[model samples]
Target: MSYQVLARKWRPRKFAELVGQEHVVRALTNALDSGRMHHAYLFTGTRGVGKTTIARIFAKSLNCERGESADPCGECSVCTAVDAGRFVDLLEIDAASNTGVDDVREVIENAQYAPARGRFKVYLVDEVHMLSKPAFNALLKTLEEPPPHVKFLLATTDPQKLPVTVLSRCLRFNLKRLLPDQIAGQMRHILGAEHIEYEDAAIGELARAADGSLRDGLSLLDQAIAYGGGSLKADDVRAMLGSVERGQVFGVLDALAAGDGQALMAESTRIASFSPDFGSVLDDLAAALHRIQLIQLVPGYRPENHDGDDSALISLAERLAPEDVQLYYQIATTGRRDLSFAPDARTGFDMALLRMLAFRPSDGATPAASGGQRSAPSPQRSAPATPSAPAAAPVQQARPAPVPSHATPALATHAPAPAATPRVADAGGMPDWEALIQRADLRGPLGQLAQNSALRGREGNTLVLALQPTHMHLAVEPMVSQIADRLSEVMGEQIRLRFIGDSQGAAHTPAARAASARSAAQSAAEASIEGDPLVQALKREFGARVVPQSIKPFES
Candidate 1:
């Protein structure tokens, strides 16, 4: 006999055997026990998540010779036949293949007949969403009003595609995907029952790789067992799943935390030697960073049962700050998707590594002096002049005096300055418009409008605001009442807000300003390179032009 895979060998025999679907199982069991069975049942969930499995179990319970109960006796002829897929009464159809109107019509015609050999004729249609619109329409009436002894069990991954007409006719039970812990627990149980030797780390890896699908997890385990011959190890499962070792991920993260450039490059090269997936390695790094963040936020939440390989991760987590963990996680997460755009996997991995290093916070130390510092003038600074033109003089500004240590406590104690008073023409005089908006706690577009709009002189029971055309467009008409109410609060009386567009001002467009700043900086850098001492020294030493290109911020 051919060897049966773990998925099929350990398939759930009854509702009790199902995992991660207690809610659905309980509802169905109560319905069966109370004799409140619906003629048609819809089971919806992702693949390998027990949609069809539950349907089969429900069918067996409905037609079990022992009577309707949550636990059907497998010894009964009806249950035995159904479990073996040989029951004439249980018609299993794959709607993916048979989705035509004619195929649906055939099923509807078959529904008119009596049960072949069981108490009820059960039609189990898998992937029912694959059926065409007209096909769904053709079976709607029959599915809603099936014969007393007929039961229809429809299963689909994408239930949204099913028409409301068909959906309304059946009782829907949505099976949730199995959680990682739940999948890991089930795997342990299966491994113990199969007398297979396995490590908890190996089971956890398989569970994560399965991504919340029990059948997929079992299939992965079956493959791992065959690969390992008998005893499953973390390395075997990692290799089979093409996942990077947790140690390598921790090494890269450690290098990142220490800000060790040479070590980072060396570790990356070693990782590339194994032909490990660069994307998955980055993903593992992100996951490690997230775990570190969790551990930092909530002490004693560390995975005490972690395998030996996780020691480096815990140490790295302790060494790195919480903010740095969050930053690296973000960079690695974003860089993983951008990896495909690189020239090669190595280059992609290198770029991702560089990105992490680039954003990594410094430990109050200057970077190495070997690599020349790359600096760009401030955006507010004017562009540089040519040789013939007079060089622009650097502007000097007075620096604020440092706060005295004795005054620091007083400064901290003082509240922020109150907003300016509004020029009011009411009997009470001017009101504080800034205080009103602050009191209202305005946010988003409304807050932006209140921040930008200037309070003009007010008329009787009216507050006038000098708003730009753009601000007026955002705050006028739509949110006028909300702004008025806030103003009313500040004025200590009811006031109307009128938005008068400012014709004297030119609105600054953010995009145009950014483009102008970039252009000016590029021109200034080109001019500055000729005057740079390092560029002159390089020209004299190596006869090189010392062209400034690919200037990146140095990581300290």
Candidate 2:
């Protein structure tokens, strides 16, 4: 007897034996038991996801000599014949080979006859979406209203290509892709029954490589068994699959977190010896980083993608900051995309790793490899000396922190516990407007309103604020009332407030003054970095260009 492949030998003979796809199985079983079967049935899903398999099982359920039940007795002639693919009443048609209208017409013409050896004649059309438009049109009416003695079982990977009219006539069952654990469990069952020696780890590798298809997983298992001389070993499977082991992947990540370039290159060399796909290596790196980030954020959160203790990932999460992990993941993904364009795979991979180290945020707040402690300039002195440029206009800004122009009006304020509230100064009995706004701790729409309004002196306990025409929309009653309330609380007096709307032309509001100050600081930071002697020397020697967007204002 010829040796049969594992996929074919272990083919599910009954719905109960089918792995995963419980949803499709349950619906079909209920339909069959109730004797409420539809005349036409459509099974759709991706390749090897059991679309055609379920169709055949349903056919057996309908024609089983044991008397039309969901569970067909294997001893019965009808069930056995269907299992062997030689049942006289089951017409298996490959729609891909015969997609013309003539073929559809022949199928329709044959519907008048009854089953030759069973209770119902079943027409199984595989890849039904391959049929031409005219072919579908010719069969639509007949498919919708087939003879009582016949049943149509149509299977397709691409249901979108089939006309909606054809789709509406059938009872559609979508089979879901099997998860890695499900496929691994099935592989273990087959190996145990076959009396083959195997490691659980080897089975896991095969399942992941299968990419959600049980048939593909079984086929890979067969090849792996043959390759391993009838015994599945983890090492042999990893070598045969040309995949990098998790240990090697973790080593690369360790080197990255330590900022050890030499260790990273050494690990890369060792991994390249297996001739593994560099792009896949990058993917592994990114996946590991993502898991590390999840662990860091959601304490005690373990992902199901990999098996066993991920203590290394947890350790890395503790060692590295969340921002660093995110930055590395982003760089790895971007590198994978650009790998094909590189001169070689190793070169691309190396550059991507290097870029991750090089492009870390300049802000001291973000952690670095040097023990998460970075030295930054004091807040008061961080902004560089601005170039002497003529001032645009005299804009008295009460608050230097600029709220964005498009920000919505916030009705109240809720400052965080650690935030320091600015002290309200008397300033010789004339309320320092900017200091007052900061002291009020106004946020949201109220913040934006105060940020954009100019302080026009107070008269008779009524402080009048001037608003530019562009900002008149924010001068609403609710926000104005909150501003007055906050001011009253801060100044220790119930000062009534009134707004002078749209009268001041091009007058600088507090937000505009803040924006101008920020622009100047950004310019000075960029100029200082660009003018550095070390930076100029590096640019001349290595042809390194500064990334402009990476430059942000620093406050000392």
Candidate 3:
């Protein structure tokens, strides 16, 4: 009458009941149904991913009282006994504990004999890789040719440790780690069946924390239920797991987006007060940033992370520059790795936040919070982007708007509505490159490519362009074709493009013009900040000196 934990109680008694291991289930089911069972079967995967569970279920399927079938009748004596761990034929071995030649010899000797109470003698060896080299050699021949009545079900989390000789003898089935959605679904089923009140978000937290193990997920769920005093709450689960809510991570990002140093620190303090794992908080931050980046770069991207508030995520995707998100993600992930070397978790976490703030993209386009204490320059004039950066994401600017880079073609053009867009030829005789790009309404990578290119006049029907050496990489066949098609559409003639490396025309490229504009804007912003009465007062009172490199001109 002792209370059984959820993991044990919910342990899959039949193949159909098992979750997130369909491939294994299908093969075993087919084998059982077709009577094509192998003598030695090895199930390998990470812990709690159903390696041992599937082995047991396969054993049950083989020895079921009704018949040898995939669907074991749970009410049958043989099946019930197997489920209860009382089946005489089912010899469960802990290879970790009994990892000697003597133990393996015992197993070998037992294999010669038939099942005591069932059709087949099933030896379920858990953590089979833990067996010593001598033990593996001792049972090697026996494993390859076990008696007709015997079956070997070897399970291991680390299959790599197993001897190739033993591995080759057996039909190896590598089980996969369960996905978050799969684990979450099972948790929901369990909670609903128990009639326990639980938030869906709480289940998600538990599932993610479970880290692709159903048993672990269930164990966490049990603990969460107990901690929440019966009903599972998102706050309680997050508190128990030493993890922050997605909203808290977003709060941190919001503060960064606003350029509010005080708000960022306060958010960090609030998170630390939870006594949460700083590494996990950084993981969450990186994960959010990843999803944000995907949203920014991937057209019509739908997040699969199952966050309830994707609208907010999309808003943030628009709010933060793509490059800023990428930078934050990089810092967060690398910071998480170096957490152990940090003096403490909080300090590491704080330093990571500071790094994000400090390294906030220098392009003058990222957003700064109004009336906020921010030292980082607004990304207005983009930093000199190396051609190596992602095509769509230009690094610089802290404005909430999509800050155009040196290569941002005010006129490159697109697949969007072409009817409303202006024609490039409207500039008359010789096509104005700037007017062509603007009128062509180029956007995305194509726009950037056009922005980085300057029209070196036309060669008959083809427009000759001078492409920056750094940006020549972006001039792929498909992009060229798209630009050609766009130009052909905008100008009432079939236009072809011939790109030449920048020799003299690089100075006249749209990107060059943008760079000049940016330089002037940057100087103006620096002068404005330096000449400000408040900044001058701070300089005199606190001996505060502005870091020149940190200054980026604010772009509207």
For each candidate in turn, the TM-score is: 0.63, 0.65, 0.66
**Candidate 1 lDDT (Cα, whole model)?**
0.69
Q: Residue 332 in model 3: shift from native, Å?
A: 1.6
Clashes of each: 1, 10, 27
Q: In model 2, which regions exceed 4 Å deviation?
A: 97-105, 303-307, 360-556
Which ten residues in a row are the worst by lDDT in model 2?
A: 406-415
- Model 3 spans > 4 angstroms off: 304-307, 360-377, 380-556
Highest-lDDT candidate? 3
- lDDT for model 3 comes to 0.78
Question: Superposing all C-alpha atoms, what RMSD in Å does each candidate have to the true structure?
Answer: 20.1, 15.8, 17.3
lDDT of each: 0.69, 0.74, 0.78
Ranking by TM-score: 3, 2, 1
lDDT of candidate 3 over 33-69, digit per residue (tens) = 9999899988888888987678778778888888999
Candidate 2, 53-136: lDDT as tens digits: 776787789888888888988778888888888888888877888877586767656777777888888888889888666656
Question: Cα miss at 239, model 2 (Å)?
Answer: 1.7
